[model samples]
Target: MALIRSILFNLLFFPGTAIHCFGVLAVSPMGSGPVQAIVHSWSRMHYWLLRHVMGISFEWEGKLPAGPYLIAVKHESMVEAIDTLRFADTPVVVLKRELADIPVFGRVTRRYGVIPVDRDAGATALRQMMSLAKQAVVDRRPVIIFPEGTRVPRGARPQLRPGFAGLYRMLGLPVVPIAVDSGRVWPRGFVKRSGTIHFRVGEIIPPGLKREEVEARVHAAINALNLPTT
Candidate 1:
């Protein structure tokens, strides 16, 4: 069943990739509103295809926070990234700089207000990320970030990067922690698998908390979600 599903998913990828490419071209000159709307629709379509092709299911716990908040999500599999877009309500993504250089993908990402960070450049990227995050908040858009910096294997714990702290400090908005077991199903790399993906959206950690305190609280929330179910 898994092999069949994988083959079906591979077949679907071609058309989905074409739609994404055309969507990117359609939005390149104007990066706002209609463009973002089109990209969001295409993204959801891609996820829908993925879910059907792979026989994967998801369960999201807790409510999405109201108003502007910094969403710090666990980074485990690429599936989580696509799921984020599929599930969220047009969020402004905070992504790595390398993605911005990709041909079609880059254009679509920029159109959707994805703030790209140069991970190798250190402080400069951090500062720019914070600036873009603040603006997003002011624009009443949620800022989604993967605080773990990079994707890690299933059940492997990666240290949360300091850049998250900087964004939290600079934005001074509520931080919502999201934890998920996406790796269990999709794992890493490009191969597809079949299973349920569990996502737990922790409470919104309000502003005015100390950086370390917020970090610790969010970390604990995600860790708690990562634990065995039974």
Candidate 2:
């Protein structure tokens, strides 16, 4: 039954996503609003498919920061990344540079002004990412980054990657770490399970701390959310 549900969801999802992306490109040229409209619509469609087809739902705890704050989010599944549009009004999501090669999806992300980080390029990639992120901040858009660099399955506790600390210090913006348990239901490889995915926003960690302090604080805050309740 789960397999059937996952299959049906994917059948609907891929075409639906492509249509929305093309529609956004046609109707609203060079605007984040329409690009975000594409994101918002797709998020709604995804959750609806999850609920109706896969018997899954989601909820959020704690409010997302109201203004131009930097957000370091828990990377657990693709669901949280897409649902970011639901949290902020067209946030600048820092994602892998390779995504830019994905045909139409690449074009849409470029339109959305997403920050792409190239991991293999080391310092050069970090510089490129930070430069774009700074411009996004100056434009008064909130920035979202996955501190762990990539998705970690439920219960896997990887250290926060280096790019996060660099961005935190260089951007000079207050950081709000967000945690979510989306992987429990929406695992990385696409077999969707039934459960409520929870997103919990952590307290704002003030800027200007040493790299060690910032890393320690943000790491604890984010990982704390992944732990089972006492």
Top of the candidates by TM-score? 2
| Model 1 whole-model lDDT (C-alpha atoms) | 0.78
Candidate 2 ranges beyond 4 A from true positions: 28-30, 228-230
Measured with C-alpha atoms, the lDDT of residue 212 in candidate 2 is: 87
Per-residue lDDT tens digits for candidate 2, residues 1-230, read 77788899899989999998897788665566667777778778876887888888777778876777889888888887887876686689989888866888887787878998887787777778888988988888899998988988887778889888888888899999888887777776756777787877888999999998988888877776686422
Task: For candidate 2, give the lDDT.
Answer: 0.82
Model 1, position 46, has a per-residue lDDT of 65
Clashing pairs in 1: none
The lDDT for every candidate, in the order shown, is 0.78, 0.82
lDDT, residue 8, model 1: 80
lDDT of 1 by residue, 38-78 (tens): 77777777678667888788788887866678888887777
